[model samples]
Target: MVTSLYIMLLGHLINRAFYYLKQKWESRALPSPESHPASQGVLPMYPG
Candidate 1:
């Protein structure tokens, strides 16, 4: 019924939001100096 449809829509929106946020965080985290092979030997990576 209407309630089922609403719940489905809400679940879809929440899943999409979580997926987007995880991708955004991983993109920002995966490229730091500590993870980068070239920078690992040269300098310490500091979190800002």
Candidate 2:
């Protein structure tokens, strides 16, 4: 029982770590919002 619990905890930690890394990788891969053409003037707040 204790071993199972430990395995569950380890799996949870690994899942979280992978999720964090995926977010970081995606952010780096995608273009920044400021550089997007729509962000320039299409949006009210941005006001290109």
In order of listing, the candidates' clash counts read: 0, 1
**Candidate 1 local distance difference test against the native:** 0.66
Model 2 regions more than 4 Å off? 32-48
Error of 2 at 39 (Å): 22
**Local accuracy of candidate 1 as per-residue lDDT tens digits, 1-48:** 999999999999999998787667656765764556665434333333
The lDDT for every candidate, in the order shown, is 0.66, 0.65
Local lDDT at 42 for model 2: 45
- Model 2 — which ten-residue stretch has the worst lDDT? 39-48
Candidate 1 has its poorest 10 consecutive residues by lDDT at 39-48
TM-score of each: 0.61, 0.62
Whole-model alpha-carbon lDDT for candidate 2: 0.65
Candidate 2 per-residue lDDT over residues 1-48, each given as its tens digit: 999999999999999998787666645654464577554334433323
Displacement of the residue 17 alpha carbon in candidate 1, Å? 0.5
